[model samples]
Target: MNSEHTKTALVLGALSGLRTLSATAVLSHYLRYNSNLKIKNRRLKFLNSAGFALLSKLLATGEIAIDKSPNIPDRVRPGGLSGRTLSGALVGAAIYSINKRRIWKGALIGATSALAATFLSFYTRKQITRNTRIPDQVIGTVEDVIAVGGSVAVLEGDR
Candidate 1:
């Protein structure tokens, strides 16, 4: 097993757990850009040809805007958390596959990271905003920046 690849895959997967929707957009972009879905990666050819990267990124950006709204529900909600975990796993697999590593193991790492990050981010955000003078909107904005920046960094690491 290549530990370096494993680590990278885990980190990328965790990004998904943190912001699954946005992470999906990033990962999809990386996959689509890295591979033309020609001879090497026939399996994911549809992702590139169908413009999944473009569409997903747009949706993810929209969600980032919606996330700051007070009307947004907790990320730990059943549907939200489940989606994050699943997205993490899928992203992990995709990343590891690119590196020619153990795909399932990477997926597990991603899922675990997502579950952990969900709790950590949710509770920490709650406490920080509650105890500090910073407005929730500001904190949320910071988080959005982190999510998008981190996602881009993780995906670029593969290249």
Candidate 2:
């Protein structure tokens, strides 16, 4: 890819991940605290899983069209998985606020996660690159782990 395109991709990918992370963080927090939450734990877990699957697919599309020689087919850039973590957190927070009938708290939860996601994105990049595994495999497996683990963890919370 051309330098300009590469730069654009890097910026866009990072931003996408940051957005996703923040969203996930809010979701995770909301679910954890929401007393009036009606969604069954299994259903909530499924929703989280669906989000990851969609995110992965989105990344794969980006890789095919823009990444060209992606190190991993589903690896959505470097910080993407961490971003997913942020998203889970956001989900939790949102639920907390909704249950309490305090909408603003949910917004704050989302904002905080967005800010944190940037740091997480950098840390994730470091970890993925530092591992001696082949770039493609590492990226691919990391993506799968994040996508699967993020959702599964909520379901396993009782354990």
Highest TM-score scorer: 1
Q: Estimate each model's TM-score.
A: 0.87, 0.40
Query: Residue 112's C-alpha lDDT in candidate 2?
Result: 52
Tens-place lDDT digits, model 2, residues 41-64: 343454344465466446544543
What tens digits encode model 1's per-residue C-alpha lDDT throughout 1-159? 877667766776667666767776777776666653121245534445448888888888888888888988898999889988888787667666666666677779888888888888888889999999998888877877777788788656645
Please list the residue runs of candidate 1 whose C-alpha ends up more than 4 Å from where it truly belongs after superposition.
Answer: 35-46
lDDT of 1: 0.73
lDDT of 1 at 127: 96
The residue ranges of model 2 lying beyond 4 angstroms of the native Cα positions read 1-36, 39-93, 155-159
